[model samples]
Target: MDPVSGELKLFLDREKIRDCLARLARGEDRRDAALIRASCWPDSTSDYGVFAGNFDEYLAWVVPGSPAIPVTQHVLGQSYFEFDGALDGDRACVETQVISYHRVDFSVEHRDTTIGGRYLDRFERRDGEWRIAARTMLYDWFQDSGVSVDWSQGVMGMPFSAPHFSGRAVGDHSESFFAKGKAR
Candidate 1:
């Protein structure tokens, strides 16, 4: 292949990998099983400390609503990639920084936990599509932000009453927006 075309292929492959990561994050936050499934190969494996298993097991553990963690969000940051070869290859090692927030609902009290971490992933291109083949999550730091916010009162005492726009584990406003075929 020509140098120019090879470079373009590399760029597109990198973007595809990034998109897969974003989709995984969004799926986790929304508890959308399909989106999460699309990000990984059926034979993939994952190790998230609390859970370590195959893709199916991981999906079952995360996609279902957990009473302890009713809400969660994952903010992805810069991603560094290392291809198997000098040019675009079928396999790559990727490390993505992330900040995750979880609303922990306890019988005694409700609190928000923020965690800074990195996802170490091995991406494999199969049938011209890049997806995670293996993944492991590493924690860097964690903070317990005592007491969750009171959404009823609204943000900063400004009565913003729009239950339909609110975010939830399932049936979130984003779902309706996507249902209208607005998403790509």
Candidate 2:
């Protein structure tokens, strides 16, 4: 193999790893089981504060819990990667930061919360495809506040924001329609 080709392969490998991280966030936000599965290896394992188990068990734990929360968002942040040149040449370790948001509307009061964390992941390339072999989440900090702003003032609590009578859904592309940022 030539030096130039080797460099290109490295670049492609890095991009694939990044894409896998993005897919994890997107799949979780959308509650897309198959999409989430694609980001991990068949024998992957996950450790999030509340749940720690095999990939299948992790899925079974999270999928049901996500819908129970009225609103949630997994905002991604910077990711750093390291490479090793040993028996596991195609293996890389990644540390990715995530800012998570959640909302709960109780009859008496509404609560808005945010959690900060990092995902420590082990990525492996199998059959030229990169996916997570292991993932561990580390929660750094968090804040929960009483709802102080009027959602009806912003584009948020408006009637036009909803497709049906109840209200707009959160955590998916459909909800992105009313968000502030430009579409991606």
Candidate 3:
């Protein structure tokens, strides 16, 4: 009956869903197993194009393989939530735009790989806590052509240590994780 109350409920629902997704992203970046386990439901399943599987198997595959890299920013936009008056849990759908770039020294345009995608999520509240029931990642476009790494200099135009893992190496890690599950 009250618009303010409705808005507050939506805001609270959205915030909880956002926080859960953020925690998942952080866990992936840091390769934190505990964080992933805590954020996702025990039976949660993620559909990311070719890679879709249960929680534990996915985590085991992802946690150890991810390499250390530059910072990643996950920008979330256009989130929608629906809660049936009779239902106890909240259902939320969000669109996320993730921009990931790597730079050893200079943060230039050429060194950036822009990837645009949307995250469709369904969250359910259980025991006063929210958990993701199902999630999907939809990629709209991805541009990989970027600046060349100057390996001869061993630095990206600045005095710094060389990258332990190259772009190819990082890619291999991802492929191994996602591909392994698909193979089986």
Candidate 4:
């Protein structure tokens, strides 16, 4: 392939890999198993520090809210990619920085935990599709804010009193929005 075409292909591959990362993050936050599954190969492996296992085990531990942390948001940052061989190689090593916020509701207090981390991933292109073949989560820093927001009082102490005012671990407001065909 010519240099220009090869560059374009590499760019497209990068985009695909980025999309997979986004899918994985969103799926984990929403606890959407199908979307999470689409981000990885069937035989993928994951080492999440607290949980390390095959794809199936990882799926079960991550989806449907394991560890009982009800709410989470994963903010993705810069990603660096390294192709296995030439630009046309089917495998790539990717490292993406992430900032994650988790709401941990304890028996007596609600705490917000913010974690700075990176996802080290091995991406493999199979059948013209890019997906994660292996992944490891590396934690850099963390902070626990004393208390989380009390959603019952609504935002800033102004009561809205509307259902779905706050996001849920399951059946979040986004689910209905997506069900209405708002998301692709």
**Structure candidate 1, residue pairs in collision:** none
Candidate 2 local Cα displacement, residue 21, angstroms: 0.6
**What is the TM-score of each predicted model, taking all chains together?**
0.95, 0.79, 0.65, 0.94
Whole-model Cα lDDT of every candidate shown, in order: 0.90, 0.77, 0.63, 0.91
- Model 3, 1-184: lDDT tens per residue? 4777777766777678778877777566556687678778888888888688888777886676433334333455555565655333355555555544433224453354556777777777777677777778888877654664655466656654544333332333444555578954
Give the top-scoring candidate (lDDT).
4
Please list all clashing residue pairs in model 4, or write none if there are none.
none
* lDDT tens digits, residue span 105-159, model 2: 6656667888999999999989889999999999999998777344555556554
Q: 130-169 in candidate 1: lDDT tens per residue?
A: 9999999999999999999877677777877687644667
Give the better candidate number (2 or 4) by lDDT: 4
Which consecutive 10 residues in model 4 have the weakest lDDT in total?
A: 61-70
Off by over 4 Å in 2: 86-88, 105-109, 148-184
| Total colliding residue pairs, candidate 1 | 0
lDDT by residue (tens digit), candidate 4, 37-131: 99999999999899899999999988777555888999999999999978779999999999999999787887899999999999999999999
